[model samples]
Target: MPERPRIRLVPLAASLAVFALVLRAVHALPDTATGLSAEMTAGAKASGIKNVVTAVLLDFRGYDTLLEIAVLMLATIAVLSLRTDPDALSRRISGVAGPVLGALTRAYVPIMIVVAGHLVWIGSSGPGGAFQGGAVLGAAGILLALSGFARPRWSSGAPMRWVLAVGLLTFIAVALLPLALGGTLLQYPDESRKSLVLLVEILLTLSIGASLTSLFLASASDTSEGERR
Candidate 1:
């Protein structure tokens, strides 16, 4: 039987009430944040990033962003833990990809790769960055899957693991590097700020791409396993 509307409304109302309370608390603050743009703009210049928003995310509040990356990694780990067998897609691996869709994927994948790189490159100065570029790369991965690309018994081999971990490792290392130089955590020295930010963005973009693609592959694996059962 379908759920009664009133039963659904009970939980819905409770959630709404909680959300309203949180909003009220926020409203009570005399603007929880003020002069945020000015601060971010100044910091952006100092961080050697042309985009203030990007600087804020990857440099100014980098510790927070680092925690967010950790959360993403944890989520990926949780998803991987849910899979019982990684080899379930072995037979499906041999299927040939062809026809118009395959050709289209071939064409698009390279373009997406280039576009993603462009986004990352321009991100320091414009309205793009690791997340946007990573999303493009993730889309390319999906397109590849649609083109009948198959997974190995373990698609997530050492290379895959490295791609997944590189961004995080680099970020932490960069953050701690300042400590070695007597700078605070995640602080980029003025001399190398631009190069460092670019390097981190490139690594992070690749990591995000791999992480998202891994999640997609895992979901597909789960679906395949279910059908077999």
Candidate 2:
């Protein structure tokens, strides 16, 4: 007969202790909830950004957004490092795309590109942003890959690397440029606040899109290469 697995008491006790602490912390909170909607709304208005969420993300907490973008870039690098293929970006899926899939990919990819642009453009005033737009763009790339579309040869080269780095570089430059001007970090001049935010969003969208696409292609290529071996 197979032996039953034993529960490790030490680790289980540690987990229970941590859970109890979390429960105590949760229980200590007041029944009533406080919100900062008014404060965020005022901040948004002062910042001249119609979208409160955008104002909070890009102006009030710009450094956090910057770090998030850097993390995404790092993740893409990690994925690429694990890939065995040197030209992962140019690799197509293993099988030929069916007629329906090929036709749909041809039609939808352009629409997805347009939608991504629209998302980024409307992010300043609506419930969309660089991340959302970049996700759509990445999806378009994945669809193309699944449809057996081979990336252009140049996409596997330095230009693609530059595209992946541009977002983080632009963000870092913007963040430090204010310091050079004797202002605090990420503090855009009053006149160019909106413009700066828009610029950052655009560049971030491109970088995020490229990074996500690279991650997918690299992982898929790695899996395919392993199977063939």
60-115, model 2: which lDDT tens digit per residue?
89999999998998888887787666565444445478999989988999999999
Q: Looking at model 2, report the run of 10 residues with the lowest lDDT sum.
A: 86-95
Winning candidate number (lDDT): 2
Q: CA lDDT of each candidate?
A: 0.81, 0.84
What lDDT is obtained when candidate 2 is compared to the true structure? 0.84
Q: Which stretches of candidate 2 lie over 4 Å from their true place?
A: 1-12, 31-33, 87-96, 152-155, 222-229
Please list the residue runs of candidate 1 whose C-alpha ends up more than 4 Å from where it truly belongs after superposition.
1-4, 31-33, 150-154, 222-229
RMSD of each candidate relative to the true structure = 2.6, 2.8
How far residue 164's Cα lies from its native spot in candidate 2, in Å, is 0.9
